[model samples]
Target: MSFLLTSCSTYPVEVTSADQLAGVWEDFAGRTVEFKGDGTFTATGMDEADVGEECSGVAATQQGALSLSGTYADVTFDGVDCEGMMLAFYGSPSSFVVCFTRDVTAGGCTGELSRKDDVTATGRHE
Candidate 1:
């Protein structure tokens, strides 16, 4: 008799709108975060050791039949005192959040994306 093992594959499920991510968000350290609708976001700053190295790239957000993507610059957090950059993504009519981090070395960004009243996705950006 022979036995075989099967692997499972999982794809990322995309959230359609920024309205799905409305709420007061908190980082792993319990810091309050605010994501604006007009493609603006604010977070308590973190440290260089906390955020890691800088990251340069682009990100996109899609709503219904509309999609927007753009290049982003590096920005350190405001209050947390971390050495990282602020990354913004546009979604929905006026929904967007700014992500701040040096790199994906640590657990990742403290904030997350949410839908309705539940966490749709959580993790650091690579």
Candidate 2:
């Protein structure tokens, strides 16, 4: 005789409002994204000398706006800003992520939204 066991984990916390998104998130390249409560955001810690299609870090330095669409938020830059920038939070409010994709139609773009550390927020960093 044998027994079978299974385990499940809670899905990452979905960002629903600007209040939930208001905080600082640092990417793998040491770039930081500061999301403000007033539908405004600022990103820093990127060098203009190194920018390209593959490197989305440049978007971090550009001023952008956020509009929540369901559980995901779309980030559009000003002027000729970064194309296809999206924001999503997982695991917890402390876990922030950003993705660069025009759309995830078909089977969905996997492994794009990476986890980032939440540096600060108004009062929702727990």
Candidate 3:
């Protein structure tokens, strides 16, 4: 005689929201990033972070639009500044991926932007 057994595992995945990305996010290199509901974004930095920072184009997203598009000019990063465009899809409010052209100085930086996670918003860093 023989017996069979079955097992399964489950994990929880966090969902993203447009509101989560509405605030400003800064990188380790002191860069301020803000995403607006109108499919617009603004980034400010100094030196390396501001090598080619410029907002050239604009876009819009409706209530049901799942993707966002925009253009940029003289954006800089990683010691390289170039002009290019960026297309980002809605992931979670905390995380997102920006696909851009070669106009910016830096390549692509992927990370999370969370105001709640960073206590600095409340003047506390711990």
Candidate 4:
């Protein structure tokens, strides 16, 4: 008898607009990034070693815990325009959305990759 084996690899989707990435993604270590629909984003525990630092992009708001309000710039795969953060969002079929670590001098993302199922929205319109 003879047997054959094959493997298939899946690739993550390159997120272009903020609408597609509007959600909260968490990694295995609880690291998370919330891509608000209002063109803003919030990142928590971005460090691999568990840092209790929370960063909110664009405007700050009291809407609630982990929320952003007011008009803000668009966040794309290229980078974020606020807080000197460089976050890159992507889509994955296996999970939901994802954020990958970048190679930059400024805040070019942290952790390896984060993915979650929950979603929260605001604006993110042109």
What are the Cα lDDT values of the candidates? 0.32, 0.49, 0.33, 0.36
Local accuracy of candidate 4 as per-residue lDDT tens digits, 1-126: 111111111233444445655777665455566767655556665432222123332222212221211111222222323232234333343333333323232222334344364322321111
lDDT of 2 at 103: 49
Model 2 weakest lDDT span, ten residues long:
1-10
In terms of TM-score, how similar is model 2 to the real structure? 0.55
Q: Model 4 segments beyond 4 Å from truth?
A: 1-12, 48-85, 89-97, 103-110, 118-126
Best-fitting candidate, scored by TM-score = 2
Tens-digit lDDT track of model 2 for 68-91: 875457766665456556654334
Q: Which prediction has more favorable lDDT, 2 or 4? A: 2
Cα lDDT tens digits, model 3, 29-122, are 4445565554345655423212223532221111111222222222222222233433322232234333223322343333322243453544
Instruction: Mark the regions of model 3 whose C-alpha exceeds 4 Å error after superposition.
Output: 1-20, 46-84, 87-126
The Cα error of candidate 3 at residue 65, in Å, is: 15
Q: Tell me how many clashing residue pairs each candidate has.
A: 13, 1, 12, 3
On the 0 to 100 scale, the lDDT of residue 20 in model 4 is 52
Please state the error at residue 122 of candidate 4 in Å: 30
